[model samples]
Target: MKARDRDDEGRARSARPRDGLGRPLPYGAPGVGRQPEGVVRRPAETVAEAQRLLDDGMPFHAHEVFEDAWKSGPAVEAPLWRGLAQLAVGLTHAARGNTVGGARLLRRGAVGLAGVDPAHGIDVAALVRWARELADRVEAGAVVDAAREAPVLGGGGRGRRLE
Candidate 1:
């Protein structure tokens, strides 16, 4: 095995460490690296799958799902998915106590989602509203409970398809 590769314990010596929010830290830093495989772009066929991940307190994982869609879905829908991913990452940051970063990402995500069509299986207006509100709160230094404030994809009722 190479020096930077995983050892018998399955730990990669050269893996970039990450903080609780799943953001990569400096190499050789004192923190655990998130499992790399979970970020693979599978491109969820339905928004419900991503919603479930968010509801389950795994926004970072949900971000990966949205990211997959952004990377592989229809070209026109990339912005929507990218926005969702940013929203998820913002929530992740909030949960990890990075209020400033959380607010910034939430605002950016809201901006990205602002112009998405509502008929595209997501309530774009509602999402943008929620994101903006969350961003404001985070910016005001509010301690957000991620689980309680987790955004639901495709709205609350009637599941929506991504394709």
Candidate 2:
């Protein structure tokens, strides 16, 4: 078997490049740059960066941002971060045509975020609503345009919404 690529810490990791939707591509093929993992950032920074990634139609990358928060941020906030990560992955799946996976992840994410107090302008209620609605629509045979329909994460006076 071919040896797996190892990260600097020597853990095996995929060296394959990935597409915009985070699909693995052939080695040596040009692909989208990946979001660095395990970055420790302030809550506001996390939300800002995540919003930019989502606006850029890179939900998979956004998920990485949320994952970092979930892993490194305050324990009390883990669920919100984790839910956001799942929601991003759901969008990724939907964009990639995995309806079942998309719907499942989306619902799971919404459940994770349900009733969480809004923190750092995350607009938890709006996000949960968007995730649930999108999942329902996608399951009912609606096509997903992840980028165009990406939710505007609250911050900078931008209201929470999906358009």
Candidate 3:
């Protein structure tokens, strides 16, 4: 079969590219574009915004916010933001029913948070613990309610209105 053709099982081939985690890229989607590492049009200036996105059940958007911080913030703080972004993406995967991917990203995010200080406006330790627990549950085939389980950004503070 041709690369663009269906497989032997007759499954249609995907035309979109995939990210590192195998999530299909929504090319041509509104507000979507190819960004280089450390580049974003508007980075989240505070964890509160990221939290609001998560509480609103937009983990994918939350990931972008975190990614912007990771890429554009101080070098010393990159890992923490990157880890948070990964966790958000993991939640997004879980919400979409990709358990394995969710678990993997959760674990990775948890590990990335190791040795980070919590003074960066977020509770790093608590977030890591939550990520690990979520990862375990996902690995065991639990269905995650992303909104109900969304992480409280900025030291467990209240997030903005939910979606």
Candidate 4:
């Protein structure tokens, strides 16, 4: 049939159960073929999207993206992304006088970002150093000096351009 029809049929079939080899997963199956080990597959993507939203001053939307990714389970960077998402929401909260929530999320995000190196993606030591330093500053509770901090955080502000 048509592509849309096929997709619809697939979704419908996926709702039912069958034999193991080629069976459709029951609702909420932990890992369909491409799903992550314990988490759903989109944490990384979700994080990127959330970052985009956050840059656009859409903290609420970013929070939802991170929340959905966080629920996916055991993503390699889910903790980091979720923590960052929480941080964004916390910033929003703090702006609205929710210091408790903002501090909590920022603390969590810093912890989550520990030991991660953006240079791993491109093998650039400078980038890694920058990322590590940014994470360190965040954890140390210093006001993030974005201007001086940009190069150290890799790509001279690549994160901002992503959105």
Among all candidates shown, the one with the greatest TM-score: 2
Residues 7-31 of candidate 3 have per-residue lDDT tens digits of 5678785656544223577754334
The pairs that clash in candidate 2 are none
Off by over 4 Å in 1: 5-44, 155-163
Report the number of clashing residue pairs per model: 0, 0, 0, 1
In model 4, which residue pairs have backbone atoms overlapping below 3 Å?
A: 130-152
lDDT tens per residue, model 4, 1-163 = 6233234336422334322122345556653232222234454455455444544444545556656666665567565556545555554444334445545655555555556544223223343333444444454555542222222121232343221
Alpha-carbon lDDT, every model: 0.74, 0.89, 0.73, 0.44
Candidate 3: regions farther than 4 A off: 1-44, 155-163
Over the stretch 17-58, how does candidate 1's per-residue lDDT look in tens digits?
765456678877887434344343434354766777667666
On lDDT, the leading prediction is 2
Q: Which 10 consecutive positions of candidate 1 have the poorest summed lDDT? A: 154-163
Lowest summed-lDDT stretch of 10 residues in model 4?
A: 146-155
- TM-scores, all candidates, are 0.72, 0.93, 0.70, 0.43
* Candidate 1 structure lDDT: 0.74
